[model samples]
Target: MNFRRLLAATAASVIATTGLVACSSDSADTKDTAAAAAGETITVGTTDASKKAWAAFEEEAKKAGFDIKVTNFGDYNTPNQALEAGELDTNNFQHLKFLAEYNNGNGTDLVPIVATEIVPLALFWKDHDSIDGIEGEEIAVPNDSVNLGRAINVLSQAGLLTLKEQGLITPTQLDIDEAKSKVKITPIDAAQTPAAYGEGKPAIINNSFLDRAGIDPTTSVFQDDPASEEAEPYINAFVVRAEDADNEQLHKLAQVWHTDAVQKAVAEDSKGTSVSVERTPEELQAILERLEGQLKK
Candidate 1:
């Protein structure tokens, strides 16, 4: 469930469906708003298409004297980059593993301020219904560094392929042991996985794209258990700069997502795909540190 290995260049359309905003200008890349502005508008970046589900939370924040702006994005790459550049006040798209990978690779100190939803990355097939039916087919996997290894792990668990190094958290396409695998592996952008599925072709699709493509990710051919110990690293979170961890409005923004109303919205709206998580800062920080260490190596 640790998708810190490869994160592919998701298509621009993901944002198109999710509703994107004007690109954050370089002029306002870094924020100097260190002081808490009473009732100030707070913009939180995200890739979730159904962010309107949080309208209640936004309203609650407004009543409590803060404006909440949910900024939707397309690619997984841009949110953290934008957050690190100070374009967004915070972001809630990626899991802890993805954030740790971003921090390690990019030298950004974005920290998970609060827990959000934890979805699955399961093997999805369009033309074929089952994994066994596509034994001779070529499967598409992510080429991104953070998700590639995890994608490989999912395929390996399906008994279709073998990695050169087994049990790696961040392996790439080069790690696949072709001699021992039955299916052909094709690497492509993570965004393309859902669209790439076709007759005799398989793709290990992430839930972000699965939801966008209208596929019920919870019913994937195979997927990780959100409550399983193996999946602890994949819990999604609202991330902010280390310096802004104590910002009251940011804390309130994080608090809104954990409410029962928002939780119900995520479940009912996402069709039970987005699993809510509640982990203490100490717990998540420890996990992040461990993941960051693994990524650094």
Candidate 2:
């Protein structure tokens, strides 16, 4: 897999229609689980397969007697696209908010098998040491709808801005109460947020871009608390087609992410920014349903 090419793909890449797959029977799911347990290769897709955590996860899965094939994708949409097309059994690379946007936009019903972790969106700046007392300056945020809402929430939490609706799941720039806001928001591509910050203005940089840009995660002025209830929508998870939601072996593979080895590697890879979270499959489905419903409205 060309890691650079995948990373180079913008978050705004076009969403192709993910043709629906028919639901399978419970007995079929049981048989599939049995096959996986008997050493059938489970093809899992992810964007960050090059991360250290993946190597650890593969080792752990081997110990648990599951043959895991981790296929790496370059962009956010392709893995879910592959999963929906039955080309991949499962994929772990996006949060519920992102998944909701994908499903609602493309009319696909991919579901989360288990919760994974949350990496908080953060405010970074080159010239400012604090988020306060800086007024009328343009702060760059990711323009991708899912993350733009998150970035706005981060600024709101820091008292840098106010939202017209207090609990918007996917707020936009028009939702901001600009008259009362301390800083002006400039929407830009997420991958370009770091560059915007380097230009001496505050930018809401996603954790995924911090390392490559040589920005330390610890240097963030303010970040959302991943453990909070408000952060639930952003919890990342291992997603499979809705029909495969109950596949036991796949759920077990998702749980392998929380093992000590995987967690340690994740911490090191994310520089302690990735907060491990656990939510039952039912809870994840409930969250996705709620988000999807709200999105449709």
Candidate 3:
């Protein structure tokens, strides 16, 4: 099935299992009580690759009077849809780019409330030690649009491929300016990039996937531009429905996430694989615009 259909099915399943309830105003006593109850049992949806990251967040949430229950999804597509359908209170497995694309394509009005991490994408090889030595070698990348485009852009930025003079937010392989590198590019499922690496081929693996494969981000050879204006929008963050952004429980949860305790936990648990970023909404919007411009070009 196509991605949209799969997402619809997933959302249907979640809504079927969890009765959808109307969201009340912030001043409603019932809403406050419901939020408190929800805090005692907030369901967070994410992928297995992000378990460690969320565990740190969960511990911090508990210290802030929340008892969080995390549920793992096998793929990247389901979490936001589940959240919008009321199956999950929030999710933290996606970057702004993916969230924006999901919102645009699926019409889901989810919004990010907190910045969490910068999981650097790494260009890796099993046999070759550097990007220059990968000539004639097979290189694997994510097949999905968002990740695939990111892999291609990273390769382009590394001088491995020349993309058409187009914006960056959603550049594809078709934009590759070829003649820049000699390596053969192959598209593989994002989840399978790690295994492909073990098979002695070069690959671009997402930071979380690298962790799942027991590969350390600190040791990768060709790292993406983590601080580039092009990468800001792609930094992962926490997302909730737009209507719930001002909910008291969510605000409290956001506060706990920004504390030094959570930041330290994220750094220690991810082993410095993921960097935490807590920005005000104004600052985040500015960063997002800058990133969007860089990506668009």
Candidate 4:
């Protein structure tokens, strides 16, 4: 079978059989025993950059009656692939746009269960103390497609450069009119942004990577909007197989992540690097649809 058809078949199979659960006892003692017996140990895949956030998630999951095991992946692409292959039960490292792009491009059926945090891109410099002082230097940005475009958008938002009329969706270096800035623009891997900043060039680092690299957002020279309408599409979420959307356990897991305690912990631990946002599933669906449309264009 062709790859797209194969993915559709796999997604259908996963959706069809994920709902079956064995009946067990309901008494308090038996319930404890049964819950323990049913205490499924499911693996969740996420980027190493999200370790602190996921640690908060793990604590919250324990309170919500789940024994979730989190496995850290070094990069963004592997987690969903792990989920699709049954190596992981779920993942929570990506925003709606990233997930939609992955599914469309690879023919996967991964789906989101809940919104989690907003990891905004921040512009930082080694020599400069503020955005106004960043002129006449080289700026390092993520060389990858998703982040390279995002870096340009963040730079444009800061009035550091001007983009073509096509807007920020998929901007490139050519889209930038370099004559406007005395600085040179260079693209580097997202992971290397912090080191690049330390070496005297300004870099646009994704929030999670910045957190992992121990850079405080409060000290960043310039930051992307955390609550802007433009950033709504980049809100991170808990993702599962399309078939697992209705699973009671996963629904409960989503509740744990959205609680007051989890939100507070994320805000504190992320040190403003990640912001928690609450939204109805219907609202999130609409936002995801809009982001997906932008990515496709």
Clashes, model 2: 1
Best by lDDT: 2
Q: Which tens-of-lDDT digit does each residue in 123-151 have in candidate 4?
A: 88765668886767678999998888777
Q: Which candidate has the highest TM-score of all? A: 2
Give the candidate order by descending TM-score.
2, 4, 3, 1
State the lDDT at 178 in candidate 4.
80
- My TM-score estimates for the predictions, one after another, are 0.72, 0.86, 0.74, 0.76
Local lDDT at 185 for model 2: 91
* Model 2 segments more than 4 A misplaced: 1-33, 127-129
After superposition, the stretches of candidate 1 with alpha carbons farther than 4 Å from their true spots are 1-38, 63-66, 72-78, 81-88, 127-136, 179-182, 211-219, 246-249
lDDT of 3 by residue, 132-230 (tens): 666667679999887788788787677776777745666677777666655657998999999999998888988668767988666666876777766
How big is the positional error of residue 21 in model 1, measured in Å on the Cα after superposition? 32
| Candidate 2 C-alpha lDDT tens digits along 1-297 | 221122113122322243222333644454544555453678899998999999999999898887879999989899988987877888999999889989999998898978889998889878667776567878899998778888888888888888888988878888999888888899999999999888888889988789889999988888998877679899999998765565566778889999999999999999999899888878988898899899899
Over all chains combined, what TM-score does candidate 2 have?
0.86
- Candidate 1 residue 114 C-alpha distance from true site, Å: 1.0
